[model samples]
Every structure is written in C-alpha cells, then in structure tokens.
Target: MAEDRKAIVPVWTLATGDVRAPALAGGEPMTAERLAELRGVLAVMADVPIATLEAHPLPDKLDRSRGIPLDAASPLAQHLSQFITQSTRSSLTAARATAMGENLYRMVVPAKVAAQFDKGFICSMAAKGTVGGIRGPLVTSTGRIAAGATFVPVGKAAAAGAAGGAGATAGVAAAGSAALTVAAPLVLMAVAVGVSAHADNKRQQAIEHITELLEQLHEQKLEEEHSALDGCRDAIDKATAILLDQGKLGVSLGLDSAVHAINTALGAADRRLARWQTALDKLPDDKPVEIGTLTKSFPGVDEHGGTFRAHLELAALAIALKRRVVVLQAVDHAQSDPGNPFENFTRALRRDQQRLDELESGIAGVLVRLSALELARQDGLMPVFTAGEVDRLMRAAHRIRRLGDGVTVNGRTTDVAIEIARNKDGSVVVFPALPMGA
Candidate 1:
C-alpha cells in the first residue's frame, strides 16, 4: 500500500508565470500558497474576475502524469505544431533583429556615448523596429490552424441512415429510421430490377437535402451582410437628413456642421458594400457546395445533431458580418462627427477615426473567439493517429533534419513535418504539421 501510494502520479500540471502547480505534490499535494501565487499572476495577465483568493506554496518536482506540458498526444499538435514552430521562428527573427540593432549602434556611435550606452541597447531597439514591422499579420498567419481532412465514425453513419429513414416517415429532426433500414436491404434483394432505381432515388434525395441546406446557409449569410449594410446606410441617411434640415434652419442651429466629412465617410461605406454586393452577385448560384459533398457521400450522416454545419455557417456569417461592418464603421464615423463644415471637419474626422479605431480593437477579439470556436469543431472531425505512428514518423524525420530532403509518404509528396523534440520538462513530444497542400 505504501509503495502504491508513493508511485501514484498526478493527472496534470498548470503553469502560472514562473510557478507550476502539479496535480500532486509529493504525497502532501499542492498547497494554498502556490495556488494563490498562480491565481495572482493569471489574474493580472488574463484580467479574470475571481472571488477573494489566498496564496499557496510551490511544489519542487512534478509527477510525469501531471507534467508542465499537457496533451503531448493531442491531434492539435499534430496539425498545428509547424505553424507554432513558424511563429516561434518569427519571434526569434525579431529577437535577432533587436540584437543586431544594438550591434549597429555600437558600430556607429562615438566612444563617449557608447561608454554610457547599455549593452545591446541600440541593437535591441533596431530589432524591435524590424520585429514590429512584421509582427501582427505574420503572427496571425502563423497561428492559422486548419484541419486537412474529415472523418466520420461508422456507428454515426449507421445511426444517420436509420434516423434519415425514420425522419422521412415522421418528419422530425430526431426521428428514428428503423423502418427504412428494415425495408432497404430486403427491398433491394427481392427485385434486382428495382435496385438501381431505389439507389438512384436515395442518392438524389440525399444530394437535394444537402444542397438545399447549403443554399439556405449561403442565403442567410447574404441576408445578414445586407442587413448590416442597410443599417449603415440608414444611419448615414438620418445624419444627412439632420444636417440638411439644420442647414435650412441656419448656422445658429449647427445643422450643416460636421456634414461633409460625415457624408464622405458614408460615401466610402456605400461604395465598399456596393462593390461587395456586385462581387457576390457574380458568383454562380449553381457552384458546387462543400458540406453538400460530405453529406452526399454519407446521407443523413450528421454528427453532433448537425452541429458541425451550424458552427461553420456561423463562422461564414460572422465573416460576412465583418465585411459589412467596414461600411458600418464609415456610417458610425459620419454620424458621430462633431465638426463644423466651414472648419475643414478636423474634430469630427478625428472623433470618427477614434471610433473606427475602437471598432478595430473589438474586431480582433471577435475574430479570435470565432476562430477558437471553429477550431473546437475540429476535434469532432479529425482522426487522431496512434502514438506509435506519430513516434515512428517523428523518429524517421529527425534523422533528416536541416537536410532539405523531400519527404514522400506512399509516393505522394508530403508537406507535413514530424517534430520529435524535448519539451520544457525533458519529455519527448511528436508535433505533426498539416499536409503540404493543407
């Protein structure tokens, strides 16, 4: 019993700044002081609201199960590790730039100024400038995680077939398809002549239903985008009406004030949306749909109660909303402007610009949250390779590191990379990259 107790491992470890809280700390376990310290750091960094919390003591060595880096076997690492590595590389490059800047300063500056200068100070500033220039969009691109393939479980496909048959009879989302299953195989065997007919009908029905839903989603996105555009236009129009009415009322009423800048911004919004609408109109309505093919391949085979499409549709809709939001921003600027028309509209333009800036700040947060949501759906869709398979790939690739040798799997050029490296805690992790085309 004592041996077993001593051998027990923790399930996980949470890192907070410099401190780590293991699930188990010896046999004594984690203390309050350590937890409090972790919570304090997290509170400051994340700005999380917490109840009155206390501090905790730290643990020395953490258990293997409760290690610093969790989920060493995650598929996310398999598909996204390279992107993370790329991001890390970008950071390193920026750091190098900073280091280089200080070197340049030392090279250029006089000795008297140089003697007083901090080590690597000039290099650091130059590196910062270089890094800052490439930071934002580069980071975002590096963080762009995507799933390369989709898989459906056998049981789910069967269930979908059964449910689809039942739904035809019952007209309900969760209806059972026992009747169809019972009749389907038997009906085909009884008459070979009707087999092709039955299969064709089934295939057509499946395709129709899938395509119909796809069209519906597309239309919904369009409507939402249009609604945002319309709202922006309405706001601008109202502000314009106010300005014109006041202009008639005279300069004393300040009606014509802030009018031109507001109108100019409104005009920009209208033009942008008009261009978007025209582009959308050009896309053929009969174009092939994505989810439809997935559905057609396995009719009525929706996992998570069709939640997958719902999530994807929401992402599409959100992007569309954001596109329209650019126009909405112009509307906001015009409506919120407070400058007089005769004064060259500086104050109003500045105020509108500030509002635009605030809108941009909020947009990034919204996009990140939306992306996270989209990524969360991946767990349900992607197949996870076995640990042995991951290990084999990683070890095989490790021998060829920095060799620039092309890796081919099953004779196809593979863009994916296998990372076999020690993590912070000295444990080996296998990080796989998305397929090359991916």
Candidate 2:
C-alpha cells in the first residue's frame, strides 16, 4: 500500500500555481514535456500575491482539508509547497465520481429495465392472443399500429395444425382435434411465461451484483485511499514543520533534508490518486468497470448487455473526468494570485472541457437508444418498451449526466460541466466522497 502511493506522482510537478489534485498524480509523470510548464509556474509565482487558508468556507473540492505551508519561506521551499498544497486536495472526487456510476446503475437502471421487461412481456402475450390481441389492436410500436402494417394472426402459425384438424369428419378424430385446438394457445403461453421468467431472474441478479459493487467501492477502495492520503500528509507535515520552525537558517542548514522529505510526500500522494491503474492503484476510475464491477456477477449483462455496459463506462469516465476539472478549477480558485497566472491551466481546462463535450454527446446518443429500445425486436416475444419505461431510462441517464457537470456556482461555466449536486439534496444523492483523514 505504501509503495502504491509513491508511484502516481511525477518527480517534477507544478502548473503555474494552478495544479489540479489528480493532475499531480497519474499513471506517469509528463516530466519531459512539463519542464517548461514548471519553470513558468516559478515565474508566475514571483509576480502573483499568494495567501494561505488552512480551512476554506466552501466545501473542499475533494473533501480533504489542507495544512497550510509556512507563509514565509525560502524560494525553493515556497515553490515546493505548491505541490504540497495541491496534494492536500484529496481522493474524494475520485470516490464520488465512481460512486455516481455504480449507484446509478444499481439503484436506477436495473429496476427501470426490469419494469420495462414486465410490461413488454404482457404486451407480447396480448399480441399472441394467449391473452386477446383483438381486445384492442396490441400496438408494440408507438401510437396505434400504422395504417398499412402487415398483421399476422396472433398464434396462427404455431396453432395452424390444431385449428385445421377441427374439421375432421370421424367422430373420435374430430373430438381429439377439437381438444388440441383448445389447448394450443395455453401451451404456447406457458412457454413464453417461462422465457420471461428466466429473463427477469437475470435482471434481479444484475441488481444484486450492482449493489455489491457499490458496497466494495466504498468499504475497500475509499477506505484505502483515505489511509494512504493521510500517510502523504504526515510526511509533508513533518518536513514543512521543520522548514517553518527553522525559517531561513534551516534552509541554509538542512535544506536538502527538508526537500527530500517533501519529495517523498509528493510521490506518495501521487500514487494514492492514480485511479486508472489496474493493479495497485488505490483511487477509482473507469478502467475497473471492464476488469471488475461492470462485468462481475451480472450474468448475461457483460455478454448480452453491450449497450448497457458501454453507456455505463462512458458515464463513469465522463463524470470522473469532469471531477478532475473541478478539482483543478478549485485549485486555481484557491490561489489568490492577481490577474491571470495560469494560461496553461486554462488551456488544460479548455481541453478537458472539449473532451467532456465529446463524452456528453455519446451520453445523449445512448439515452435516445434506450428511450426507443424494443425488447420485441431483440427477443421477438417481448413488446416495445412503454412510454413510461423510456422515460425512466431517460431520467437515469440524465442524472448521471448531472454528475458529469459537478457543482458550478458560477452561471458562466454552465457549458463546462453537467449539474452534479443541487443545493440541499446533495448529501442524499452523492455518496460520501472521502473519509475523515483524506
């Protein structure tokens, strides 16, 4: 676990005093490309006036509170402290982004999908006349059956022989044929009921699977992340305390030691937040959906539910990416620097915002697909989803879309994200993003 935390941070980390929490930690350091960016931060810091806030009035973006670096410092110590400050913003964003998907899929999608299944199965029976198709035209598609649509007699193909034999002349033969004709529709209905039952069972299993996934994400990964983040803070606090107490003389004396301890702290924090790593990564992200939650214990969901898995993966990734931007935005907001100190940060934000635009497009497309989905087309026996079913699915996707937005107090940045938590209902909707220490 300790080693896991060390690998996520790039050795060289800084971004014009606008460093994002996740950006400081990732799969690998962009040291080669970001050298110039680091130098730029140093230049900007000189010109910008900075302030320290041990606690902010606003909700901490990742829900981790930061310990301020000593206000007065050596230039080297001062510059390095920026890394500590960003690291202080923790893994709550990752946890929240992850929970948004798991909970939405668990609590929302399965129930809605199952309800559609029940309605479609009923429609199928009516269309087959096991229940009466002629009671009223059993229209599977929207409105009533289209004007010239071809009609197949509900159970005609399957029951043809039995119905035809009813005209037999011999007394015994006629009696038997009449009985077969009477029993045919009943037999067919029994079969459809069995198939529908089997499908419903799978849906139930999927809901259970999703529930377990949500539980593990909170109980395991979230817990581990908080513990690891605390480790990072402890390392930084020890080193910074020395720098704070000794002041200029300490930098002149034990400067190298302080720098080394700070570096150790940064490395740990980075690894702790590498949500994308498959093996030892403590944080949460989309890659795990393929490897774990989305695929696990969902029966045919992974195999037959291609569209289901795809939308979920996209939703989870998109929301996490948005949270990443919000964390960066929060960091940028934290710096009390005058004028614009972060052209690079703003450019990064713009790039992420554009990617989100692409993701949301994908999200919207699937929503349409879900809204129009016809189990009748997919399974032949079930009918088209009812309007209510479509609405339910659409509502789930829309809520997931909101998580991608994150909370934006400023009206101007509306285009930047989906609306995450609204004013008071946030706690009810958003799962706890971090534990106490993180």
Candidate 3:
C-alpha cells in the first residue's frame, strides 16, 4: 500500500508593526530617570504595545505642539489606551478570514499541505480479491454391481451364461467389470471441472467489488474539491469588501503618505541621534552616556556625564516609534472598514496618523511573528501515520523532499528533505531537512 502524501504547511500569524515612532520631545534634554523610563517603555511595547497605546492611544489626537504628556500616569486615567489598539488586531484577523476564506487559511496550511490532506484519507481496507468465500463441489457415486452378465444376447445375463456354459459365463463377468471401471473416471473428471469454474467466478466477483469501492472513494474526493473551490470564491468576495473599507479609512485618516513620512521621520531621528552622540564623544574618552541601569522609570545616576541628555533623547525616540507601530496596526482592524481604501494609492494621504502608528508598530511584531513562522515552516507538514505503518508509507514524501533539494522557493535555494515519522497512536509527523551550510 502506498503511504498518504504529506503537504507543506506554513505557519502564519498577524503582523503587528511595520513602522513606528515613540512619543519624545524633538529637542528635549534627557535626564537619567527619563532615559531609563523610555527604555523600559520600548521593551514593554515590543511584545504587547498595550501600555504604549494606553499611554498615547492616538498621537494626532494629542496637542503635539504642547509636547508629550510626561506626567499623565495610570492614576489620572482608569484604563490603558493600548487595549483599544490591541482590540483592532482581532477585528482584522476575522475580517481577513471572512474575505479570503481558504486563502487566509492557506497561508497557515501552505499549498503543499492543503493539497496532500485534501485528497488523503486515513482508513483500513482489505486487499483486492480478499473478500467473499470459496468452495469446491462435492462428488458422490450411487452404488450397485451387476453379477454374472453375458456378452451374447440371451434375454437375461443369468440365462445367457447358463446356455453358454462356464467359458461364456466367465467372459460375461469380465465385460461387465470393464464397463463400470471406464465410466467412474469420466464422472470424476466432469465434477472437477465444474468445481474449478465456480471458484474462478467467485474470485472475479471479489475483484470487481474492490474496484467499485475504489471508484466511489475517488468520486467522493472530486465532490470535496468542488466544495473547497466554492469556499475559496466566497472568501475572495469577503476580502474584496474589507479592502474597500480599509481604503475608506485610509482616505479619512490621510494614510496615503504615512509610509513615506514614517521613513523620513526615522531617517531624521537616526541622523539626530548620530549627531548627538558625536557631540558627546568630543567631551572625554572616560565619559559615556549614563542614562541609567534601572529597569523601572528611573536609572542610577552614579556617573554624571552630560551625555545622559543625548542618551535620553535617543531612548525616547525608540519608545515613540514603538508606540507608532502599535497605532498603525490598529488601522488594520478588519472591523474598522472591511476592504478599507487604505490600499488606494491616491488616498494614502487620507489615512490618519493613528493608523500609521498601528502599521509601524505592526512591523516589529511582524518580525517576531515571522521568526516564529519560519520555525513553524521548518516543522513541515503534520504526520497522520501510525508508528507501525511508518516504514510502509508511500515514497511520495521522500521524493518530494529530494526534489526540494534542487528546487528553489521565492528564489532562495534550500537543501531541506521531508522525513516522515510515525507514532504508536497512528499519527504521522513530517520533519524538514536542515538548510545547506547549517
């Protein structure tokens, strides 16, 4: 029996931030306490930007000219604004699923795995010609022997023998015995042929039965394929609707040039940070940027070097970018506007800064997600085989893995082979080969 084929499954997760900027004053002097606080915030926002968003849910909503609300702590507000931003993540995933159907799921399952499992079935069936019963015909002979028969016509055997005398009688007995011996073998031969023919017919019937079952299974697979295709179409429609909504949000929020602005801002910040460090470098070799060592809102001020001011500014920007990323991701919320026109190039300027923040924040989160995805991808397709049957699977997986060595994905070469492993509970596992140079 051929083993069921395996499929390549890619792991997928939502990308949280692609771009971001923390809330820091453009030309503010940094203090040891402020620098430490900024670093702490950036670190916290990396995994869950809930704190950052809660602190400054919407930067545009704030009075940018008035500067960051450094004093606004949890005591002032009952809840955090980050939660509001995070809520959008769920909305977007749902919307994506609704619009894309299998497309969205395909990202996680991968085209390979989907194809394999789509046609693969796990079941037990008898081999061909193994069903039904076989039997041979029974032979029997009715018995009675005639005695003292004569060859000549004499009305009856006993009378003929009597008239012919002893010689005639003996000849008549021999002739009767020869006749019975010849007829017995012929009867046995005919019975043997009949039994052989019956058994052949039964064997053929069993083969046909098995063939029919196989055909039915094939037809069932075809029906499923049709159903899955329909689902894909439905998903496309939903995705289109959501895309339109996102476009509208883009127009309303002025997100058209957000990406460009983000890049520009990051570039400027990078340059400013560089220059600030250069200035501090001229002061003395012994002096370094002493922002702080504390993990909380403040750091130790043991070494008082004026470089702390510059350090604070740099740290603050990192935090601010981190916050922006979270806000940007929030715009992707599917519920906000399914098919939002945000993708509309003409309306990029229409996207709000809040949306920009979400997108930027999403970048970082996406990086982490991507790393996890890659690891999951390495896990290859799942197994659906039992331990005892592992060695008996079809060679499809091995062939595919070998093909992968010479094949390229997205233009990158890999030497990964697919190895199928089975467990005792009738489960199958697929292991990807190590990359070349690994």
lDDT of 2 at 360: 37
Q: Which segments of candidate 3 are over 4 A away from where they belong?
A: 1-248, 280-283, 286-322, 330-438
Q: Judge candidate 2 at residue 53 and give its lDDT.
A: 9
User: Each candidate: what lDDT?
Assistant: 0.24, 0.25, 0.23
Q: What local lDDT does model 2 show for residue 433? A: 15
lDDT over C-alpha atoms for residue 437 of model 2? 9
True-vs-predicted CA distance for residue 252, candidate 3, Å = 4.6
The prediction achieving the highest TM-score against the true structure is 2
lDDT, residue 94, candidate 2: 22
The total number of steric clashes, by the backbone 3 Å criterion, in model 1 comes to 19
**Worst lDDT window (10 residues) for model 3?**
137-146
Q: What TM-score, over all chains together, does every model reach?
A: 0.18, 0.22, 0.17
How many collisions between residues are there in candidate 3? Answer: 72
lDDT for each residue of candidate 3 in 235-334, tens digit (9 for 90 to 100): 3223323332223233434333443443454454445445533443343444322122111112211122122222332222332332232223432342
* Counted clashes in each candidate structure: 19, 4, 72
lDDT order, best first, reads 2, 1, 3
